[model samples]
Target: MHDYTIRAFVQGNAEFVGFDKYAEVFGSTTFPTALLNTAVFTLVSILFQYAAGLALAVFFRSGFRLSGVLRAMFLVPWLLPLIVSASTWAWMLSSENGIVNSVLGAFGVPQINWLTSPDTALLSVIVANIWLGIPFNLVILYSGLQNIPGELAEAASLDGAGAWKQFWSITFPLLRPVSAITLLLGLIYTLKVVDVIWVMTTGGPGNSTTTLAIWSYREAFGTGQPDFSPAAAVGNVLILIALVFGFLHLQLQHRQEGS
Candidate 1:
């Protein structure tokens, strides 16, 4: 890739720099923190999102009264625009007069800063992201649940299997294919998350929440003086990460089928 900059773009005077930009990005001080944040954010969000979604899907599958209405309500977070959701979270987590703090205050807890403190900024965004992703997992996993034959559960119950045993012995094993795909898709989505985080904390309180995606976006557009080449390099690294996971998924699938 070429060493492109905002001024060079306007003047058509870009110069080829080969891997210099990549070298610079890898050597930068922020790269390690960004990489670690990205990893923690992605892994934590996916794990909780999938667990909560699967639990909700199973709950709704029980055919309780008003279940449809409750499930529909769960989709509200997913239906709302990212900016709206992020802004709502930001408002709710405000240290002063926020509903969260107000409720905590009633219980004799301190008013803690959610976004302003480095200690909790990353956690704040992760919580918001997990909330946003649960609906997606719920929908997909719920559909997968439907494909499982009710007879299997019926037979397991008749054989004296408890709910937990039925779930572990029959439901979970049958849902493996669906779970794999859901996790893979969630990983890809979480990897490029910027809008929600940007709207909430702008990767701040001092790069505490700055993932690789944020780093790339900040370099390219967050500032008035854009550094295009390094942004491109970081973007490419993200792509490589996604592709590596995708290929690993394929390999696992192939191995499963072979076995």
Candidate 2:
């Protein structure tokens, strides 16, 4: 990469800097915080999203009355545009008069700042991201469940297996391939998330919510004095992270197949 400055880039005189920009990114104080935030944001969002989505998928597997309608409703969050969803979350989590705090107020709880406060800002964004991710997980996992033979569960039921036991021994094991892919895709998606957090916190009250993606965007465009090289380095770091996980998934899948 090159040491790209706005003026130099315009004049086509940007100087090649090799990996200097990467060194700068690694050495910067914000790098540690951004890396940690990115990990927390990605991991937490995936865990909860998968759990909630799988639960909903299993619930809907019963094919209850109006199940189709209910399942479709869950897809609303996923179908909504990112900006719209983020803006809606921002409004709902507004500290002064948010609907969340309003409900808390009725229960004798004080109004807590959701987005503005550094302490809760990361949490707020994570919650919003998890909500956005659930529908995708539900759809995928539900399809996976369908591919699994119902006869397996039926046999387990005949053997006196409880619902929980059937799920753990039969349903879950059969769903591993699907679950792995779902989690991998979720990891990739969550790793590079920008719009939702950007709309809600813009990296925050004090960098508490700044992930690698936000840091990269901030360096390149969030401020008037754009520093393009370091931003590119940060973006590359995210790509490397995603690739590492992608490779790991492949390796594990290969081992599973070999076995």
Candidate 3:
């Protein structure tokens, strides 16, 4: 990979001479677009997963009938292997006989080409990722909710606090730690989400769904010609983003402890 990049640099086809490959990749338009797409994908997945998971956690915490069964059912997707999950989603989103299009047809809607369309391809992968993520958040948050002191809620109620008030004052506060952990872990997982996109789209439709990870993989392995330098550059960018989140989370925890 490095040898090819060096050769490319030596060929003078790329700018900056010896580091031509790096310059071309870094200076290319595709790099920025890939970064933006990935950022949006990660942000959207985390937002929806955390929100949906928190809601489910709250609902299941009430000990409603069949809550245990429901919780297990929600976790089924998470228990599946990632490749299996991606493949299943790919089948489900296929344009012709896919369940998604079938349902749309039943409702008198046009069949949508999820994987083939650049507009919806990234979103299709994001939806699959959200499915993979929500269960984890639910399990963690539900367990955290279970660990909170019942006495605190009871005390709040005794002080004439309503259910909503008690929850805001007691339940949500106690779940802060759990929420933090969930968000941090979710960010890490979403940052590295490649399989779902790979299996479903292969960064297709004019590279609309190309993420940094996918782009890096293609550069290193695609075209039967490896270029490790650009791939390494992409890897470093992803690591840097993850590291930023990790560092921020740690600082927040330390400050909370000190306070």
Candidate 4:
């Protein structure tokens, strides 16, 4: 086993050649593009998912009829296998036979090559990610909303505060911990997203939707020759980013608690 490990490292090092591989990656334009795409995709999807989840949570928290059933239905997307969801969306977005384009065409709107067009490819992945994540955010925020004492909102409303004011001043402040935790967790998960983008775009139509995780996979295993060192570096970078976000979340919670 030890000999095999050493042999693997030796073969991998032959290609890496010290920091040469690192320099090549940094100098490559595709590297920066992948980084930017991943950042945008993660940020936009998380923001939309969180906001939509919060709205849904608040709406369902109002105790409407079939609220429990509706909540379970919303969660169905998250519960489904991610690959299955991604493939379904991919088929739906296919320019020729996709239901999305077909419906749009029927309405006199132009059909978009969602997964094939460079401009639309990354955004398409983000849409899939948002759909996959909404349930997670909704469930977490809804539980948090349930734990918030009703008396707090009632007292705020009695003081001549309107619904919006009560929510902004009382409910939101109490949900801060829940929000912070969800945001950080979502960030971490988004950073590592691969299956949806991989199954949908394969980082193609000119490498427009390539993310770091996908890039790393391509480098280490997808290519003709395996490059483990750069893959390790990419994984390290992702871990560092996740750690920083987690630390910031904890700090935010500490400050909120102290105040």
lDDT of each: 0.94, 0.94, 0.86, 0.86
- Candidate 4 lDDT tens digits, 109-134: 89899999999999999999999999
What is the per-residue lDDT of model 3 for residues 1-259, given as tens digits with 9 covering 90 to 100? 2434656767845433465556777898899889888988899999999999999998998897898998899989989988999999999999988999999899999989998999999899999999999999999999989888888888889999999998888899878877887898899888888878888888888889999989988877766767767787787778889899999889878866785
Q: What is the TM-score of each candidate against the true structure?
A: 0.95, 0.96, 0.87, 0.90
Taking all chains together, the TM-score of candidate 3 against the true structure is 0.87
Candidate 2 ranges with C-alpha deviation above 4 Å: 249-259
Candidate 3 stretches with Cα past 4 Å from truth are 1-21, 253-259
lDDT of 4 at 246: 81
Ten consecutive residues with minimal summed lDDT in candidate 3?
A: 12-21
RMSD of each: 1.7, 1.6, 3.7, 3.2
Candidate 1 residue pairs that clash: none
